[model samples]
Structure formats: C-alpha cells, structure tokens
Target: MKRQIVLFFALAMFSACNKSTKSNATQQPTLADYRVGEKWVWKYKGVTTQGEIRSEGEDTREIVSVDGELGMTIGTDTIPVADMVKPDESETPKYDWPLEVGKKWKFENSWTSQDGTKGTQSQDVEVLSFQEETVEAGTFMAYKIQYKGTISNSRGYSADTDEVWWYAPEVKNFIKLTQTQEDFFYEEELIEYSKPQ
Candidate 1:
C-alpha cells in the first residue's frame, strides 16, 4: 500500500509539471514578456536557384524606452512593443493564437512594399510540430510553423511561396526562418540574444 501511494503522488506531480510546460507555449506573448535592453541579432542571406545572391546582411533589434514607452527597433523604425503583441485583428493572421502542433489555418495579407509595389499574399499556415531547433544563438524548444501558398502583385506577377519559421516561446521570438519563393531562397538565423540582468 505504501509503495502504491508513493507512485501515485509521483505521477500527480509529473502531470502538474507537464501541464505547466504545455501552457507556456500555447498562449500568445504580451508586452509584459519583454524588457528594455533586450536585444536580438540575426544573420540573413537570400539566393536564387540560378546562384545569384540577392541580399545578405545582419539585422538587429533591441527593446528600448521611448518617452517612457517600450519600443522595439524594426528596420529603420521603432514601434511600440505593445502594438507588436496586440491581439492580431486580421481575419487571417501570421500567427494563430494558442499555438499547437498540427493546428492549421489560412493567412492572407495585402501590402505595398518599400518601392511602392503592391502585392497580396495568401497562405495555408500550420503548426507542424514542436521540437528543439538549434541555431547560432543556441538550442531552444520551438514550434515549427509552415506557411505555403501564393503571392501576386499589381505588376501581374505571381509565384508560389513556402516558408517555415522556428518560433521559440522562451525567447518570445522566432529563432530562424526559411522562405522559398519561386527561384529565390532566403533564410535568417539568430546569432545573438541578450537581456539585461
């Protein structure tokens, strides 16, 4: 009887810990998850099937205090972290909340690029699996999300595109991304991440 009781208690403790871990990955991140001075840097390169290197560079983003508001650098702009994590109002969003493996959804967006080229995107997004993915920064438990679909533009051009993103909930960001569109291949991997102690 004593042995059985001890085993039962051990199982209960394990079950509780499992639930706590699973919940950590499912929920969307909020501004509360970020802190000023946290930084992330990634190295990216894009190439074509014909062996032409289109773009290559490293991108860095840091959380900073902007007039008392928490903002993050995105390219040349600093946007409120609050806005970045706000409840995505899009009918078809880049990320579906409460992420879970095997979950699927459609994502669509229309935008004008920096050069004023207007384009539209439509993709079927799926959370393929959750596993440990290693990058230059380090290994972390992450979700493998896939986006497959087509992109078309006002210039009457269209192409099929597929992308996979490894999002690490612990980092509150994607650790790596690979995108394939027609003859072009692009990928970015996190090289460094830091947070103020």
Candidate 2:
C-alpha cells in the first residue's frame, strides 16, 4: 500500500508538469492576433544629407478599424490596410509571417508620388536573429530583420537604403526601426503600446 501511494503521487506530479509545459509552448504571438484598437507611440529622429538634424519628434499610430485587413491612423495620415505593409502593391507580404532566423525574401514595387514622381523599389530582407529587447515600452522577445534595398526614380536618380527592424510579435508591430538612405538617417523606437479595452 505504501509503494502504491508513492507511485500515484509521482504520476500526478508528472501530469501537472506536462500540462504546464504545453501552456508555455503555446503562448507565443501570431499574425492572426493583430486586431483593431492597438496603439503604438514612437520617438523619431531624422538627419539630412549635410549631417544636420532635419526632424525629431514623437509619432503615434492607432488601429481604428480592421475590415478585410488592418488600418492605422498616424498623425494626419490615415493609412489604409492595404497600404500599410506593402506600399507598392507587391505580391510578397510586407512581413513574412511566422518569422524564423535565416529566413529571406525579395519583393519589388513601383509607385507614383502624389506630386507625380514615379519610382521603383526592390528590397531583399533577411531575419538576422531573435532575442529579448528592452525599449521604453517594455522588454519583449523580438525578431531582428535586415533590409537592403534600392530605389530608382524616373529622374535618373537612385539611392540605396538599409534598414534594421526589431519586431515584437506580442505588440503586433515593430518596436524599433533604424534606416539609412543616401546621406539621410532615421530612427524610431517604441515608447508605449496598448490594446483597446
């Protein structure tokens, strides 16, 4: 009877441990979790070709609606769902879901500016690594992605751009982004994030 009792308790403890492990494995975020009312605040700085500060300020993006896709309003700009990720209407998704290290993809798109300036851009993106990052918003496990691309305009001018982005799945958006184009530099980091009640 004593041996049987010890065996029964050991089995129960093993079952409990298995259940806890399963729960922790399934807690990671996915693309389907991005929903409306999500908000992100960022602090940004921009530098010009002459190495002078062009702009520095705060910006906020809030998801006001999600129909077939998600839509966010940033400052006075209401970016439609379709325009958020892939501005050029490329078939490749702006963010390849289920991010993994060493993953790589290439996409291209052409666009005409509001002022009628036409251009084409292509980007080669790679997932560099995944690690925990602590920004002003909080600490999160994020995927670090690198983007190397080029843009050419009808005016016979072209520029190369490099961008690094830290995307936290829990936030359903990027927590930090650093970009360099020609002699211009820009950086934005998340200060806060919230989900709608």
Candidate 3:
C-alpha cells in the first residue's frame, strides 16, 4: 500500500510539472493588441564617422489611424500602416509579429535616399532576451533584439552594421534603438508614451 501511494504521488507531481510548462509556453504576447492613438516620443543622438557629434534632438511618432494595421505620423511624414508592419514569406518583416525569445530571421532591403543615393541592406535578427527595463518613458517588460548585417550604398560606401532594439509589446513599438555602422552611430530612446482614451 505504501508503494502504491508513493507511485500515485509521483504521477501527480509529473502532471503538475507538465501543466506549469504549458502555461509558461503560452504566455507570449501578440501583435494584434496595438491600438490607434498610441504615441511614442524619443530622443536621438548621432555621431559622424570622424567622431564628431552631428545631430541631437527629440522625435515623436503618433498613431493617427488604425484599421487593419497601424499608421504613424513622424514629422511631416505620414507612414502608412502597411509599410510599417507587414509580414511576408518573401520579404523582410518590418517588425516580426508574435514576438518570442530566441526567434531568428534574415531580411534584405533596398532603398533610395531623397538626395538620389541608393543603398541595399541585409541583416540577420535574433531575439536575445526578455526582461524588465527602465527608461525615460517608464519601467516595463521588453524584448531585447539584436541585428547584425552589411549595407552598401551607390556612392561606393559599404560597411557592416550592428543594431539593438528594445521592444515593449504593451506599447506596440520599440522603446529604444541603437545602430552602429562604419560611417556613423545613432541611438534613440523613448522619453514618453501615451495610450488612447
């Protein structure tokens, strides 16, 4: 009888362990919860290749509209929702949805600057960790992601780039970003944020 009781207790403990593992696995955040009117303000600083400070200022983006996706207004540019957050099998996702730790992907993109300069970029991104971080905006849980890759410009400038981003699912936007390239380095951190009433 004692042996049977011990066996039953062991089975019960194993069942509890299984339940706990499943619960933790299902706690990941989803991207569909972001709402309209959500806004984030950031302070940015830049350093030139010559080690000279170039520009430093505050920039803000506000969610002006949301239907199937989110649209943000930054300065005089009104970025379409689709351009900001679309995922596809063939193209790099602007922001990977349903974020999870240890997830990784590769992306490539080409763009032209208003001054007629063209560039191509390819990068591999990985979710490094998830933890609580405090910033000017506030303390919150965030995902830290790292991106490493190379970029080449039509001006015959090619360099390797490394970037890190901190994203908070609750805000539906990245709270901080740091990018380093051969020619320059830039960093931005969220100073303020607001949610729709």
Q: Pick the candidate with the highest TM-score.
A: 1
TM-score of 2: 0.69
Candidate lDDT scores, in order, read 0.72, 0.62, 0.62
Worst 10 residues of 3 by lDDT: 11-20
Model 3 alpha-carbon miss at residue 81, Å: 3.0
Clash pairs detected, candidate 1: none
Candidate 2, 1-197: lDDT as tens digits = 11221122221111111001222221223234546887788787788778798777786777676465666675565666444333223355344544567878885656665456677768898889878998999998777888789877777868897878887656756778787879878777889999877
For model 2, where is the 10-residue window of minimal lDDT? 11-20
Q: Write the number of the candidate with greater TM-score, choosing between 2 and 3.
A: 3
TM-score of each: 0.87, 0.69, 0.74
Residue range 27-135, candidate 3, lDDT tens digits: 2222344457867787877788787886677876676764555665756766665443433445574334445678788867766665677778788988788789888
Model 3, position 1: C-alpha lDDT score? 19
lDDT by residue for model 1 (1-197), tens: 11221122221111111111444546766667778999888887888899998777887788999999999876677878777666667788777667888889998877665556677879998989888999999998888888899888777878898888887776777788888888888887889999999
